[model samples]
Structure formats: structure tokens, C-alpha cells
Target: MIFRQICSEKGGSLAYVLGDPVTREAVLIDVAENHLTAAEDFLRSRGLQLRLLLVTHWNASHEQAARALRERWGARLAAHESVHAPCVDMRTRDEDVLYFGEESLRIFHTPALTPCASIYAWNDRLFTGHTILVRGLHPKLHGQARVRLLARLCALLERFPEETLLYPGVENQGRRLSSIEEFRRRSQHGAGGDSADLLQRYRHLLPNKRAAKQREKARAEKNLHRYGPGQDVPASL
Candidate 1:
């Protein structure tokens, strides 16, 4: 098995390239548009054929690259069932196993950050996108949903081995990796009932759907203004 983490220098978004060395088959996860060339180059250098493009969540920045990558490599695009992207060739469910050559990844639906959020487990490593960062859990979930999701997340975390390594979507605190045991210990300190109540109390602070849309629109406009027309905008923006 071959694994590499490709991180964006400009934005904090992270992408992964995992390949089965024996079979020469690879899978890319949470790919950003700016990293496409690098990813393709790496695959070519390794003599690996891209077989799958897996997304953990829907982000405008990287989502646009899915179609282009798929068309270029004939790779199948996959994501959680809740993700309504046209580029997705397969809608994955919790516990779904995705196979590429001799490598296989088990899907774990962790909706603490977003409803479409998912984590893929391969061997002792987990590709967790925006769900579990080095700092802690993402703080953008709905009120009651936060509690419910955290409970589910705790349960899921417990299921994994203590030594399992976690590769988060974004690197925080200058660290890109953590272990299930560490996260479990941290979670125990804050995932109690009080934290749930605190989250509920601050529910009003979370952005609503309209605000999120406006923010996205603002970002797109900003990108267009900054990069001008016909330029490939970095997905991190």
C-alpha cells in the first residue's frame, strides 16, 4: 500500500493519494482543483491508474474538479448518499466498502460537520474530512444535531482500534495526523451533557441556509474579481 498527503500551500485544504503498489491502482480523496496537476503527475510517476475519486463533503472549491478528473482518468466519483453532486457516480452509505485493486476502504458516515460528511477507513488509517481536526471536532453543526452527531461520533470512535491513525481534512496546530486513542481521550473531556447544552445555547450563532448561500456567492464573486475571467481559481479560495 502507498499513501501520500497532498496539502495546499495557499489554502488549508488537504487531499490524499492512496494506491495499491502491486496492482498499480490508486484513489484520490477530497481533491482540490489546484492540486490536480500534482496528483496526476504523482500517479503517472508511480505508474498507477486512477480508479476512484472519493469526496468526504461538498465544497465548491474542490467539487468542480471532480468532473474534469473523472473524464481525464475514467475514474468513478463517489460520496455520501446525501451529496447531490452530478459528478458522483456512486452514492455511498455507512459501512460501505470501496475496493480498488487489493486495497479496500470502509465508509463511516460522520455528520457532525455536515450532513454529507464521511470518513473512510483503510487499514489503521482513517481519512477524516472536516469531521475531526487536530484541534477537535468542527464547531459548525446544528444544535441538537451536534449532540446527536457527537454521540454517534463517540460511538464510532470507540469502534476503531486505539492505535488507529487519523488523517484529518484540514491540518490544524501544525499537525496533520492524530490517533483514535488521543481523540477519544479529548472527546471524553468535552463530549458530556454540558457540552451538548452549550451547543444548543449557541445554536442561534450558527449560520442559516440563506447566510451560507450568501457567503458562497460572495466567495465566488470575490474569486472572479480577483482571478478575472478564464483563469482557474484555486479551490482553497
Candidate 2:
């Protein structure tokens, strides 16, 4: 088996390509349009046929190129069912196993980033899309459901092997890869939580209810300025 990491410098998104040497069949995970040409050329040069194109999650930053790639390459396109788009040829579920010629990949559903967000693990490699970052976790972006997802991910990591290699989404000045053990430790030490709550608690170490109220108050004030007085913006809307 062979692995390739494709990094998008703009959003710090990472895509992957896994290939089987014997069958010369390859699978692409979360490729971006900007990197598509290069990825395809690299695979072709290796005499690998692009068989399966799987998406870990459907954030615009990661999936905008999926449609184009599928159309151009005629490969089977896969994604979480929540993507709810015709572009997806395979609707993936948690623990769904995919075979790329000889290798196997397991999908782990993690709603931390989105309802259908997930990570893909194969062998000792885990392609964690945007669930965790090296610099810090994004609580503000994750919200409430994300916290629950992170906790689950933390637990799942405990079962992973020590040799697991993590390719995180965040770009930092230092380390790039992480082990399951390392991530587990961080999650236990407050890396896993409601992103907004974590930020608020870290800022003042106050209770969630109080921090939430403060967040609402700040939002009200910000919106008041944007739309002027008496233009109450419903929080849900």
C-alpha cells in the first residue's frame, strides 16, 4: 500500500490518496480542485487506476472539487449521507468498510464538525479531516454537538494502536503528525468539549450557563449595531 498527503495551503485542509501496489488500484480521500490535476498525474504516473473517490466530510472547502473529479474521472464517489447531493455515488455510514483493491478502510462517524463529519482509518493511518488540530481545537466552529463527538472520538482513540498516524487539518509551525495516544491525552486534558464552551471556560473558567449568557449578550450587541435599534434578530434565525 502507498499513501500520499495533499495539503491545501489556503484553508490548511489535507486530502489523501491510498493505493495498492499489486492491483494498481487507488482511492482518493477528500481531494480539492486545486490539487486534483497534480493528484491525478501522480497516480497515473504510478500506473494506478483511480477506483474509489471517498470524501470524509462535505465541507465546501473539502468537497467543492468532488463533483468535477467524479465527472472527469468516472470513479465511484462516496460521502456521508448527510451531504444529500446527487454527486455522491456511495452513502457511507459509521464503520463502513471500503476495499481499494487489497487495502481496507474503516469509517468512523464523528459529528463534531458537522452532522455527517467523520474520519477514515486504514491500517495505522487515520485521516482525521478537521476533528482535531495540533495548535488547538476549534470549539467556536464545533458548537454543542461537536463536543459530544469529540468525547466519543477521544474514547475511540484509546482502542487504536500506538503506531496510528494522525494527519490533522490545522497548520502549525511545529509538529504535523500525531499518535492516537497523544491525541487521547490531549482530549482528556480538555481538548474535547463544546468548542464555544471550551473557549468561554478557558477565557474565564466560568460555568457554561454563564458563559452562554455572555455570548448571547455579546451577539445581541453586535447584531444591534449591524441592523440598528429594534431590529431584533432571532437567535435561531
Candidate 3:
């Protein structure tokens, strides 16, 4: 597999280009407008055919690339069904596999960041998006929901190997990657964050059904109020 990690000019953002050596077929992950040219350049330089654009939840930044790549390279855009983007060619589900050449990446639904937020894993590398950051996990969810997110996230991480690599959607202190083992080790000591602190912080909190529903409603709005192909775009777009 061939891979390249592109960082934004101002720098917390990140994007990636991964290609299959055998087929020269590639997929771009979590791309943003700032790095689109750089990403496109790499594809051109390597003579790679962009097969798909897989988004693990980057806000509006993703829209630009989705349109550009689809129009220019004929690449399909895949994302969680709840992702509100007209350019999306595929509505992915949990455990769905996307193939490019001989390589594939599995989708893992993780909606705490946003209803569409997800993670993509291939071989031992995880394109974690905001689900699992390189610096740590700090999702802004309602109390009980936060608890559930932590639990589910832990359960999800456990499914992968300890040495599995994590490529975060956003960079932190110039640190854009970590392994499952490294995240856990840092958590134990408190230098880098882990679910432990989050668990402890919210352990005493009680569930607020009302607040949880309100949060869900807000996310629903994002999905409902977006544009779809050849349709009258929603006001939110």
C-alpha cells in the first residue's frame, strides 16, 4: 500500500492519500479544501486513479473535495447515511467494507462527534476522525450519552489489535497518529488522555433523558436540512 498524510497550512487539520501498489487505485480520506490541491497533486504525481473519497466526518471542509473529486476524477464519495451531503454517492453502514485495489477499509459507526461521525480501519491502521484523536478522546456529549460513548468507544477499540495505528482527523501539537497501545499507556499515566479521566469525571453524573433527546434533535436537523443531488438545496446548505 502507498500512503501520504497531508497537513493543512495553518496545521491542525489533516488529510490522507492511500493507493494500492498493484492497481494504482486510491482513496482519499478526510480531505479538506486547504489540502485538496496537495492531495490532487499527489494522485497526479503517482498516476493514481482516485476510486473513492471516504469521509470520517470533517464538517463543510469535506464538501469541496467531494464535489471536486467527483466531478474531476469520477471518484465516489462514501460516508455514513446520516452525513448531510448531496455529493455523497454511498450511504455506508457499520461494518461495511470499501475496496480499492487489493486493500479495503471497514467502517465503524461512532456518532458522538456528529451523527455522521465514523471510523475507517484497514490492516492495522484506523482513520479515527474525531472519534479517537491522537492526543485523546474528548467528545462533547450529554452526560449519560457521554458515558455511553466512552463505553462504546472502548468496546470498539478493543476489537482491534493493541498495536493498531490510529490516524486522527485533526492533528494535535503536530501529533497526528497513535496506536491503541500508546493511547492506553498514556492514559494510565495521565500525560495523554484516555477514557479513564472521562469515565471518572462523569461517573457521578446522572442521565438526563431530556438533554439527550435535545442533542439528538439537533443532529437530526443537520441531516434533514442539507442538499441532495439535483434537488433544491436545503436552507442549511
Candidate 4:
């Protein structure tokens, strides 16, 4: 099996293509809007036939090119059932397998990051899209949703083998891949973070339902004072 990476300049979003050398059949994972041409070129250059386009989730930034690529390459599009919009040819479930020659992909539902977020393990490699960042800094105010997501990530740490190689959903600051054991240590005792620390980063943002609404109300009033209506508000403020 061969693996290739395609990256987008805007967000460092990565798309992966895996090819079976014996059969020259390939599958694409989590495409970015700007990298479709590169994916096509990689397959074409290897004389491989594109068979599947799998999405890790249904975010527009991640999957806007699904229809165009499906039509162009006659590829079957797959995603989680929760992402029930157009362009998905197959709705995937955890442990479902997609075969490309001798290689088979096993999908695992990982709802920590988003409703439809998932992890795909194939040919001794794990392709996790955006559910865990190997290096990119998570935002400071992602709310309880992010807190819950971190808990899920901890669960995954206890579930998978230590040797499993991780290709995170998004590119790391510079690293290409990481091992599960490495991730475990990094998330537990790293200089600037840990699972509990990660959760704490969002604690203030994740108030109870009533407090959250109240916070939003206060924020709106604060914005009204600062922007004076019909004006743009700064994201951080």
C-alpha cells in the first residue's frame, strides 16, 4: 500500500490517497476544495483507478468538492449517516469495511469532535480527520462540545493499540504522522497541555445552558456597545 498527502494552503487541511500497488486501485480520504486536482494527478500518475472518496465528516469546508469529484472520477462517496445531505453515496457505520484489493478500511465512529466525525483504520494506518490534531493548537474557547470531545479522545487512547500510526484529520504544524503512544503521553503531560488542561481551556466558555445563553446575551450587548450596529465585530474580543 502507498500513501500520499495533499495539503491546502488556507487551513493546512490534508487529504490522503492510498493505493494498492498490486491492483493499482486507490481511495481518497477527506478531500479539501483546493486539492482535488492534486489528488487526481497523483492517482493518474500512478496509473491507478480511483474507486472511493470517503469523508471523515460533512463539514462544508471539508466536503464541498464531493459531487464534482464523484462525477469526474465515477467514485463512490461515503460518510456517516448523521451527515444526511446530498453527495454521500454510502452512509458508513463503525467497523464497516471498504475493500480496495487486498487492503480493507475499518471505520470507527468517533463523535467526540462532531456528530459525524469518524476515524478510518486501513492497512496498519489510522486516518483521523479533524477529530484530533497532532500539533495544531486547539482554540481556547470551544465550549462543552470540545470538552466532551476530549473525553472521547481519551477513550480512543484506551481502545487502540499503542503501535497504531496516526495521520490526524488535519496536518500537524510540521510532523507528518504520530504513534498512539506518543499521542497518549502528549495529551497527558505535555508542557502546555493535557486532557484535563484541554478541558479547562474551554471551561469558561462552556457554562450551563442558562449561563451560556446569558453569556451570549451579555456578549451581544457588549458588541452593540462596541460596534454601534451595522458594523463588523472582531472575533476575539
Candidate number of the best TM-score: 3
In candidate 3, clashing pairs total 0
User: What are the per-residue Cα lDDT tens digits for candidate 3 across 1-237?
Assistant: 799999897867888998999999999998888888899999999999999998888478789868888899999999889876678889999989989999988899988857888888888799888777786675454456656666666668778889899999878877889998887676556544345566678654534557878999998977775533435645465
CA error at residue 105 for candidate 4, angstroms: 0.8
Per-residue alpha-carbon lDDT of model 2 for 73-105, expressed as tens digits?
Answer: 778888887878777789988888989888889
Report the lDDT tens digits of candidate 4 across residue range 142-230.
54665666555665555678988888766656666777777767655643244456566765543355776799999999998877744
> In model 4, where do residues sit more than 4 Å from their true spots?
140-147, 190-192, 195-237
Better candidate by lDDT, 2 or 3: 3
lDDT of each: 0.81, 0.72, 0.81, 0.75
Quote each prediction's TM-score.
0.78, 0.74, 0.79, 0.74
Evaluated against the true structure, the overall lDDT of model 3 is: 0.81
After superposition, the stretches of candidate 2 with alpha carbons farther than 4 Å from their true spots are 141-146, 191-237
lDDT of 1 by residue, 1-237 (tens): 898898878766789999998899999999988778888889998999999999888888667778888889999999899988787899999999999999899999987667888999998899888887775677665457665666667567767789999898887767888888777676556642226455456556443557778999999999988777455655565
Model 1 alpha-carbon miss at residue 81, Å: 1.6
